[model samples]
Target: MRIAVGEDDVLLREGVTRVLLGAGLDVVASTGDATKLLAMTLAFRPDVVVVDVRMPPHHGDDGLRTAIEVRKRLPATGVVLLTQYCEPEFAIDLIGDRPQGVGYLLKERVGDVDDFAAAVKRVAHGGSALDPEVVTRMLRPRTVPSELADLTDRERSVLACMAEGLSNRGIARALLISEAAVEKHVTATFRKLGLAQLTDGHRRVQAVLRYLAAQGP
Candidate 1:
């Protein structure tokens, strides 16, 4: 995958670039300037952009504004916003109505090379990678939809893993359950959530949207 990076912290920027390069992804451009990052994104149209939540020009949500703009102009290009803090609101804003090709990760996650690289690739390929911590915070203070209230505990856990962009096998591994069981829970979740007619990918994204909606303000 081809990726562009934007971060004001030089060390972190270089580290991320290095990590992407080491993962064998093409680092088409790397910049500390938020404006330059947008310019590069328009110019190169990299498969994905790894951007800090705060950057130059205003140093407060400039990166996020650019990310939202990128999504508007280049919906196919994936965006992953990196932050030092657990800010669920930013994730909600970035996702908006369309949740595909998007990710919101904590900066510390960068240290986990394998997982971070997988997340970037996942988003680039039209999946999502919401930070689990962010999702936890989003779920902490809100109630889910009435439909979701009927989900069994196992079904709810399966839905949570799905929000993390895990495949059925991956979910199975994470939850220590059989893949068949995961599939059954997924089907039940979809039925209960009134998402039985959507395509597989769309069903997953819609289910994720409903799950995240529990955190909406």
Candidate 2:
């Protein structure tokens, strides 16, 4: 997939770019300037854009603001907003008005090349990939949703893994269960969450959204 990276840290940016290149993804552009990042994305229209949560010209939420703008202006271009901090609220902002083709992951996730590649592919192909840590924060300090109460604990676990963008096989490995069992749990979780309206794959993204709503501020 073609990707553009926006990170203020030079070492991290170069390292990430090299890693992505080694992984065979096209790195169309890399920049630390927040506005330049936005401009490059608009111009190149890469398949995916990876942005740090903080960046030049403010460093508070410039990267985030750019990611949100990309979603609004270029909805088809996938965006992955990376953060060193676990801020579920920022993730919520990305998913607030529209969740399609968007991802929110922790910067540390980049250390795992396999996971990083998976996240890039998932988002580029129009899937949501929220960090598990972010989802955990979202779930804490919030009352469980009525719909979620219908899910068994195992099913809830399955759904949480789903929010992390894990495939059935991945979830199976994580939970030390058979892939078939994971599939069953996924279906049951979808049904219990009243997410039957979504198609097979879409149900996964919608499931994350449901979880978000259940734990949203």
Candidate 3:
């Protein structure tokens, strides 16, 4: 898969490029500037972009903003935003209403080369990859009543793993349950969320986002 990287830290940028390249993915462009990153993305139209949440010229949420713009202008290109810390607000803005072809991960995650590569590939192929920590943090603050309140604790745990973009098999591994059990929980969760009609991937995204949106902020 073709990839582009945008990070202000020189060492980290090179490290990310090396990691993706070593993973057998094509590296079409790398840049430290958010604007240039967008320009390069437009020029190359890479399959996925690994962008730091902060970059040159602003060093704030420039990369996150650029990722959003890329989604708007190049809907086919996937984007993964990396942050030094867990930033739930940025993730919310990045995912918006449509969470497909997007990811939000901590910078430390890049050290896990295999998983990081898999995340990029997952997003490139129209799947999501939210960091487990990000998902946990997002879920911890909910006290309001919503559709999520209708789910059982086990179902909630399964949905949390789903929010991390894990497949049923992956969720089974994480939750130490059988794949059949995961399937049952997923089905029940979908039914309770009124998402039984959408396709699998679409419903999962909608389910997670609906819960998050109801939780507020």
Candidate 4:
């Protein structure tokens, strides 16, 4: 898959490029400026664009804003916003219109080369790969009669993992539980959240976003 990277840190940018290249993915473009990222996206039309949430000048959400614009201008291109924070608000907004081909992952996750490569591939193929912390932070009680309140702790764990765009096996590995247990929790979570009708590979992502969005900004 082809990928474009946008990050202000030159070292990190090169590191990301090397990582993706090492994973056997093509690095079509790389830039330190968020604006350049959008420009490259329009120019290269990469399969996926891995962008840092902050870039150039003020270094606060320039990449995120660009990602949103890219989504609007090039709906077919996949976007993955990398960040140091577990900022779910930006993520929720990224998928406000739709979740296909969008991802939100913590910067630290790059250490796991295999996982990071898989995430990029997933987004390229019209899927998601959210950071687990993003969901956990999003689930904190902030409203009464919340949709998330209906879930048990384990179910919530399953939902959090799902929000990160992990498969049942991935969730099991992360949580150190059996795949059967993870599947059960996923089914139960979906049923409780009324997501049964939307059952599909992306259903968990949709349901998690529904719950997170319900909490409002």
Candidate 5:
């Protein structure tokens, strides 16, 4: 697949490109600036774009913002935001919309070349890929209300997968259930959590984050 990369760190950018090339994926363009990232994305029309959360100038949410723009402008192109550390809030925002063709993974994860390549392929094929650490960090103990506490073990399991950025089909595959059954569980879980049926993508992520934050760090 044709791919583009956005990372300010020169070495990391090169490393990522090498890894992708080694996996037999074509690297169409790589840039150190977020502005160039957007430009290259439009010009190269890559099937997938890998970006770092921190980039030149703002060095905060530039990459995340670029990903959002890409989704709006190039709906068919997939995006994967890489980070040096686990930031659930940033991940939530980066992937809140278009959850299907998006991913968030730690830079350290690149060491596992196989897994990293799998994540890239998954996002390119319109699937979500989230770091395991991201899920664990978002589900830590918190002061949940008695209402939310009523969720069954299965429901909680479903929620955990949801928070990990899994789609209904993904949750079903992970849980070894049919996609229809996954939807049922998801709908039931949402109702138990008092969430609206409209909740999807980032909104669903925010809801999960609020629940986790209420439980405390």
Candidate 6:
């Protein structure tokens, strides 16, 4: 797959490029500036773009802005955002318009080449890839809706697993329950949490984010 990178750190840009190249993916362009990165993406039309959270000229959200721009300008291009810190607000914003072909991963997690490569591929194939840490922070105990508060402890566990990006089968394996049971719990949890009306995957992510945000820091 063709990919572009936008990271202010020289070493990190090189490391990520090397990893992608080693995985037999083409690194079309790599840049430390968000503006140039956007330009490169428009010109190259890569399959995916991996970006850092911070970049030059307003480092805080430059990379993030570029990601959003990609969503608008190059709807077909996937985006993978790597951040040194987990910012739920940024994650929520980046995921606002589309959850498919989107990912938010912790920079520290890049040490695992296999996982990093998998995340890239997942986003490229129109799937979500959120850092486990991001999910944990987003799902911590909070004053959930009264309806959600009614879930049994086991059901809550199922919901938590879903927030952590686990598939029904993965949740089943992790909780030592049958996949069928996991699906049942998920359906029940959704109904109780009033998330049953949300059918879009992106909206579902936002629903979970809103629930978590209401629960507080």
Better of 4 and 5 by lDDT: 4
What lDDT does candidate 5 reach at residue 22? 97
Error of 3 at 118 (Å): 0.7
TM-scores, all candidates, are 0.65, 0.64, 0.65, 0.65, 0.64, 0.65
Task: Please give the lDDT score at residue 44 for candidate 1.
Answer: 99
Question: What would the per-residue lDDT of candidate 3 be over residues 98-117, giving only the tens digit for each residue?
Answer: 88999998987657799999
The TM-score that candidate 3 achieves is: 0.65
What is the C-alpha lDDT profile of model 5 across 6-88, one tens digit per residue? 99989989999999999999999999998899999999999999998767655556777788889889999999988886867
Ranking 4 against 6 by lDDT, winner = 4
- Candidate 4 regions exceeding 4 Å error are 144-217
Judging by lDDT, tell me the better candidate of 5 and 6: 6
> What does the lDDT read for residue 109 in candidate 3?
61
**Residue pairs in candidate 5 whose N, alpha carbon or C atoms collide under 3 angstroms:** 96-202, 142-215, 143-215
lDDT of 2 by residue, 41-111 (tens): 99999999999977886555778889889888888999998778676767877887777788888877667
Candidate 1 lDDT at 73 equals 93
Query: lDDT (0-100) at residue 184 of candidate 3?
Result: 99
Clashes of each: 0, 0, 0, 0, 3, 0
Per-residue lDDT tens digits for candidate 1, residues 1-217, read 8999999999989988998999999999999988999999999999999998778775666788889999999999999998886767678778999999999999876568989999999999999998899999878875556757989767888999999999998886665456787999999999999999999999999999999987567
lDDT of each: 0.88, 0.84, 0.86, 0.83, 0.80, 0.82
Tell me the tens digit of each residue's lDDT in model 4 across 101-158: 9999998765788899999999999999988888787777754437788887667767
Clashes of 2: 0
What CA RMSD would you report for each candidate? 14.9, 15.1, 14.6, 14.8, 12.4, 13.8
Residue 121 lDDT in model 2?
86
Candidate maximizing lDDT? 1
